[model samples]
Target: MIISCYNEEHTILQVIDEVSAVLPQAHIAVFDNNSTDSSKSLVLGRIQMLANSANIDGGGGTYQSFIESSAPESKNKVPKTQDFAAKINVESKRAESKRLDSASLDSPANDTTLFNATSITPTSINPASIIPTSINSVSTIMPNGGRLSLFSTTTQGKGAVIADAFALLDADIYVMIDGDTQYDTAFLPQALAHFCQNQLDMLNIARATINDSVHRKGHSFGNKLLSTAAAIFFGKNFGDMLSGYRIFSRAFVKSFPAQSKGFEIETELSVFALQQNLRVDEIEAPYKSRPEGSFSKLHTFRDGFRILFMIFQLLFTERPLLVFGFLSVLSFAVSLIIGVDIFMEFLETSRVARFPTLFVCVGLGVIGVVLGVAGMLAHLVVKGSKEARRMAYLNHKKIL
Candidate 1:
């Protein structure tokens, strides 16, 4: 388990405790991006690692840059690697020549293939923020790649970064949530057990219904509106569309090409599956709002627009014709209205209406037909792409 969140000091321990209770065998890992709170201390029994989350040193005199940067490499520069740890690998044949091989004739030992922690991007939390959990030993986290993205005006820190952290972990399942304690940890087992029981590709926990008192007004209401919009647009609905808690099978995570860089990642995840025609399922879970002590880090307008952008993106990506065809129908309706008005005027005195309603109608009708045809062409392309992705995923996971 890789948790990418900040200011999680107060309830992070509880979250960890809940996860550990059910998934005892799992090697839970908390990647600290340098928290300024007691969050590090909250990691109960999990293995702790600190990656290079930077902080400006010396206020006035020395403000230099302090972040490692990286992007997906080109084929020539570096072939695409599905194996996460293979980037730093060295051939065993060379190790034998170096006499690094066990003289006692032991099997080829791992020499160059040690997990160089420097490659994984650090979660950005202030080091001064953590109240340092009492621990005798913890692996030193040396971050590997990519700095926090500064291009986007996002206050929602590291949503995509944390999602990438899970991606790099290269696990059989990927779970996600916000740092604030709004989700019920008690139902975690039910979530995991259901995933395992049916061997599903992905499982989303719908945080739909909650005790009224426990849910906040603004956040709750906004969630309902966006969810309703998403359901109507997609012709499918999950009880809770903005759910921060979900578990995904390895294949889904590996195949998913996440494009959103903020809170919209959640919406993107759900839309991606439906768009790709993946077998996505959901289970009901308790949803509780956070305490006043900690405020929500969501940017209402920015993320709302982002989610809207994602929805349209999926619409374009999935079926361009249907989306555009709906517009075409509206366009044709306007033409029909104008034509009826012209007919009424002609009936009165066998004369045309003062307005050039006939010309306007023809123009609208012609434009609408063109747009509808364009949409149909786009629809064909999107459907073909989705099928290709489905087959690719099945081949990768050996499902077929």
Candidate 2:
């Protein structure tokens, strides 16, 4: 289980506890992006309490080092520049060899190191022992002998955190949920069961709010509009294109090229699945309002435009033929409309008039032809890219 957290101090612990109770067999890793509140300390304290209860050697040392680590230095650090094209080429090379290492991809090479312990003993810790208590009294357990790892990086945004976690944690079945206790964890088991039973590559938990007050009106409207746009552009009706809670098979997680740096990540995820024609499904889950102190990180206007732009970007990249073809048709239509009157006049008079308009019409015609040819060529390239991505996805064994 991978939880992406920021300053979710009021509800992060509760989310951890709820996940622990539901998916005890799953190893929970919380990727904190330099939270300013007590979120980091709270997670570290929980780790320490679990370490003590499990009696795992070196666990205490790991916990202490985590506390003393320089996570503070990362609090104000700017996110690294993401050269997506270069990264995609590198990933393609790695994928060709079918040996993509998540740990090495987009790692905080120069940033301050946070908690990096990966090999802690898996011990059963009681969930009830660590509920809303002081750090010393917290006694959370790692269920089903699964270890709990906390990773802190300077990279900002939920998308960056998730990208880091996907690369850092190795799991057969990965579950990603927000730290903001808005989505009910009770739906986890059902979602997991469906994902595994159907052997899906990705399963999205579409938000079904209990009431209209659960989410902001603007957010709700934006989600619908974005989802509708994605459905039309991608030809997939993903009920909630911006849903944060999702499940992924190893293949999907390892093969995904996470490029979004903010709330647009969800949009990227949905489009990727659609472009690849991966086995995916969605189930409606109850969505609740955030805790009083916990706030939403999403900016309605800013992120909405970002996501909308991402959709068009993906369309141009993944379905270049469709985008260019539409433009080509528009170009041809305009050229014919303008040239029709000019051609009729020339034929009737047997003389050239409005040469500039005729030139414009001819130029548009040529551009239309060029765009059409370009679309076809780009379509071929996109097909090849899709095949390569599919091969990379197939290299990983499915959970079933």
Candidate 3:
């Protein structure tokens, strides 16, 4: 199981504990983006607590070594528990001061932070470079003999962190859930059961809120609009396309080309599954409001527009004929509307009165024809690309 976290301090620990309860035997990896809150300290504390328990149960390793094993490349060892606690206290005070100072600045009503794709370069680190060389290695072992790894991505967006995790983690079945603790972890076993039983490539956990107020009006409307748009474009209805919780088979994960750098990654995921005609399923899961201190990072309008743009992009790339053909028809219709009267006048009078209008109409006609031909040719190229990707998807062994 993989959890993507930012500044979710209020509920991160609870989320971790819930996941641990649900999947005690499974390795739980938490990938953290640079969080200003005490979230990192809280996670580190949990790791220490777990490390202590492991030592008591005859699992041989210290908390310090476990931290080092998670990131073998780092030169500095984490400070011991007491020193770490002191550092966290000092840092928290400084963060509070900074927050107060910035509170006076005008900010968007609901947006915590606007995602800037170009700000952070995509991560280049390979999975092999970070994962423990051997699962059985003493330094890497966790409580109950399952690995609990904590990693921080230098890249900023949720999509970037997830992309990095997809590259770094190797698992037969991958479970992705947000760190906000809004979705119930109770449905995990059932979701996993359904995924494996049907041998699905992707199983989306669609959000079904218990309370209407829990679902923001703007976000709810945006999700419905985007979901409908995706269904129309891709010919598949996954119900809730923006839901953060999902399960994936190794075949799907390994084959997915994750290119989106923001919230629109969900759109890309759905489009990929549709384009490949992969076996997919969806199960309704209870969604709730965030804890009081925790805020949402999603900007309804900004992210909604981004997701909409990504859908059109996928449509153009995957179904060039549909897009270009529609434009071709539209162009021809306009040209005929403008030139009809002029053509009739020329026919009756046997003379040209509006040569410029005629030329403009002719230019539009030519453009229409060119677009029609381009669509046909581009459709062929897209078809070949799809075939190549399908071959790559087939190369991976399917989950039994």
lDDT (10s digit) by residue, model 3, range 59-100: 222212243333333222232434211011112222222110
lDDT of 2: 0.71
Query: In terms of TM-score, how similar is model 3 to the real structure?
Result: 0.80
- 1-400 per-residue lDDT for model 1 (tens digits): 5555566676666665565555542334454445567665554222221221212112221111111113332222321122211122222332222110000101122322222222121122122221111112132212221111111112344555555454445445556655566777678667877877887776888875567876557666777887777777775677677777888766777677777666777787777777666677898887776766666657777777777787788777666887899889988988888788788878988987566677898889998898899888888887787777777677656231
RMSD in angstroms, all models? 12.6, 10.6, 11.9
Q: Tell me the tens digit of each residue's lDDT in model 2 across 34-123.
A: 899999888877776665444433322212112223233343232121200000011222123221111211223233433222222122
- Identify the runs in model 2 with alpha carbons over 4 angstroms from their true place: 54-144
Ranking by lDDT: 2, 3, 1
> Candidate 3: lDDT over CA atoms?
0.70
TM-scores vs. true structure, each candidate: 0.65, 0.80, 0.80
The true-versus-predicted C-alpha distance at residue 5 of model 3, in Å, is 0.3
TM-score-wise, the better of 1 and 2 is 2
